[model samples]
Target: MNKPYVIIHTHTSIDGNLDIMDLQAFEEASRQYQELSLDPEKQQFEIQGYLNGKTTTEDNITHYKRPELDENAAPVPEGDYVADPDAPMYYLAMDTRGELAFEENTFGYGGVPSHIVVALTERVSNAYKDFLRKKKISYIIAGKEQIDYDVMLDKFYNLFHIKRMMVGGGGTLNWSIVQNGLVDEVSVILAPIANADPDGHRFFVAKDPYSSIEETSFQLKSVQELEHDTLWIRYSVKKK
Candidate 1:
């Protein structure tokens, strides 16, 4: 199946810990991401939407509300229900459990894109469906309970013509994408500090929860130092 080009843009510490927790807020690190990503290489790749996991979306996104679904709610089409991805910027939130609430079609967050796409699963209740319709926010059913990242990504390409996509958020989302061979590239912006959380998360979450750490391969594309003693590195995922 055809898939959109995917890039996971994220930041961490020199020790490779991504969960800054109480040490730094997401917006602050996100600002750092924006600054470091100004590299000509990343800038050249056009992205239609930036994808985020449910937790990160809820934490970083605000100013949206849940309104009652309309009695005259419109039905979304079936059979690989598609839409064009190239028109406007989108913040695709992977909310498989139908737990998110939004007021407008777009998120009110600053800096990042405005348009929002709430990715859902079949298990989402009809009431929630109505809520989304009432809000006029776009969504796609990816699976029964959990999201099928590959299928949804292809849907993004087919419906929206989104050729390039960037996924930035938590380790679970990034690890899932890489584990599924969905990511073509990885961009890491490392803050040169020792803010590692003893019980914090890292860049990539392993596919197996109990498995020991193993070596992964990547071809270094570019490396540089940005302002604030940060190290910006880009690497192409290499299949072994």
Candidate 2:
């Protein structure tokens, strides 16, 4: 936790799926989260989706209601829909428990980092806070107010002094951190599978090209295999 250094670690298939089904990465990330998770309900929720939004009279919630991405916002670099630039990081996922609030596909790995710090708007619900807290996780709700990213990064660095911070994200979170040039390293795990859904999230670039690093590079540290014929590779991102 010397200073807030960022590392983007993600696993994707050639078909473009991102889930814990890639056993090695899944087990590694989960072992860490499991060690820290204290709440049984929250841990159970990881296996299922935590309920959000409206509930029916039968105490069941509907699935397949995909939230709309903001139109006024810029599209993702890969040219997919994007959210309001000012919006709290929209997690395009269901809770780990997989209870069903949105789509009903059994995808997503929800492994909590040592500290899952979220930069969200004040509009985030109390239930959301409770859910994270139940897992013994801490959060930073930037509130409806926008925080100076640099200042907030410094605070996170100072607060946790986390030696190595791994950022496992969907897309925008990765883009924002990379665009800001705050990341020190990045690890992209390319799985040999693909998703025919073009609208489904792409690994990185979508439309506009992002800023490039003149000296950005990585050194391979290790490579291993996981259950189900998956692979685990490690790289040390060259520090700028």
Candidate 3:
């Protein structure tokens, strides 16, 4: 990792559910998320980019044709491509299985930089590589079977020049990064209510059955109230 700092940022209810089913609550949090997210001074890092897990990225995709992978084909040459040197980069998706179908290299988002990068494992097929090569979208590969989080981050640092990235996505992706000892800060917009949904995801979930959340320590960095009674809190993940 060239410049090693990552903040796992999320918005969750008081009860720790990510379901966020209520439309009103979703809209409010989203508004606050944008405000807090773009504030460069507070975060202490100009977010060169951000990330999304497969589920989070796939959820927003409307639908499109997917590419076929040829298992025997050579791996795509390792590299990066920026549409515009100054255009902001957003939503680097962890699509290790080569599942996403991008219509173009740069897809515009609401006032924010609209760009995408597909993170891949070495196992991704050659045909898919050809598809990505044709599309001219940016991509990086890490582990052989699964994405090596550390290597992936290094690619961002070395190739894309992303020093500090905002880890913006679901628990699985967040937890994987945390478990790899890559997370420095746990930032959240604490919603006022304790909305419950048994089906909803938690702030963090361990992959190993024996792994304990209690064992992972954190020191509260700062706390402040936002416009809508939403609390912005930052916790520094304490290392052993």
Candidate 4:
């Protein structure tokens, strides 16, 4: 394949909601999710990184604070920047508009270190790029306004040599990539409890601008029951 094999991995409720009411169960499920990522036998391919959308990164890492940018700074030379190309693992954040203010270039998951790679668009300010450079973070520009996931994935393979990418989402990102037909597999850790909140985040939500997205289907791949009544389900996206 020209691009990396994309896998959408997440923990969700029985109703396909991202919100789970049981904290204990959620933690257990999350632990299992991490284990699955490291299991050599289960992971036939080397997963170079985990990808997230801008909102998810902000909620979990940045907390919605805007980055201090130099609006009057000199324009940065255009192109992708790879600060640490040889890093073993990565934490790929899809911040199309360069909204994230990362404090560091590395993220830790399951005690394993991963270099941060921010995905940006041409519309981002030069100051944001400079901030990332100061932090030694890697970045890629793939679109003019919105993200062109296809081009981003291509660069991931050609530049960073990321052959297999695991996408850990917050609904909008998941649906966006899947709708673009970029995902290969859907591996979800099904939590036992559900928060029936109508406003709760879902496993996959089509963004407002993606109203014309077609209904996609999946072919069942496998299912395994985990502890605490949690379940692991894998599906192969049915490509057109």
TM-score for each of the candidates: 0.80, 0.45, 0.85, 0.92
- Clashes counted in candidate 4 amount to 0
lDDT of 1: 0.69
- Which 10-residue span in candidate 3 carries the lowest summed lDDT? 78-87
lDDT of 2 by residue, 1-240 (tens): 134555666666665555345355545544433322223444311211111112110122234443332334432222111122221111222131212222221222343212223333445444444433334333443324443356445444444333334555555445555666676656555554554566655444322332343434567876765445555566665555
Report lDDT per candidate: 0.69, 0.40, 0.71, 0.84
Q: Tens digits of per-residue lDDT for model 3 on 1-240?
A: 454478888888888876655667666876687656654444444677778667766666626456555656666556444433344655577767777877777654434655667788877767776677677777787777778787888877777767678887687777777777788889987777665777788778666531345467889999988777788889988888
The candidate scoring highest on lDDT is: 4
Clashes of 2: 28
Per-residue lDDT over 1-240 for candidate 1, one digit per residue giving the tens place of the 0 to 100 score: 668889999888766687654554443555668644333344545776778876687666642344454445565454332233444667778876666766567754334445677778888766677666556677788777678876798777777667788887687788877767778899988776556567676777764541234577999999986665666789988897
Q: Candidate 2, TM-score vs. the true structure?
A: 0.45
Candidate 2: segments with Cα more than 4 A from true spot:
17-117, 120-147, 205-221, 236-240
Native-vs-model 2 lDDT?
0.40
Which is better, 3 or 4, measured by TM-score? Answer: 4
Candidate RMSDs in order: 4.0, 12.5, 3.3, 2.0
Looking at candidate 2, the ten consecutive residues that score lowest on lDDT are 49-58
Distance from true location, Cα of 49 in model 3, Å: 0.6
> Which parts of model 4 have CA positions greater than 4 angstroms off?
20-22, 38-45, 210-213
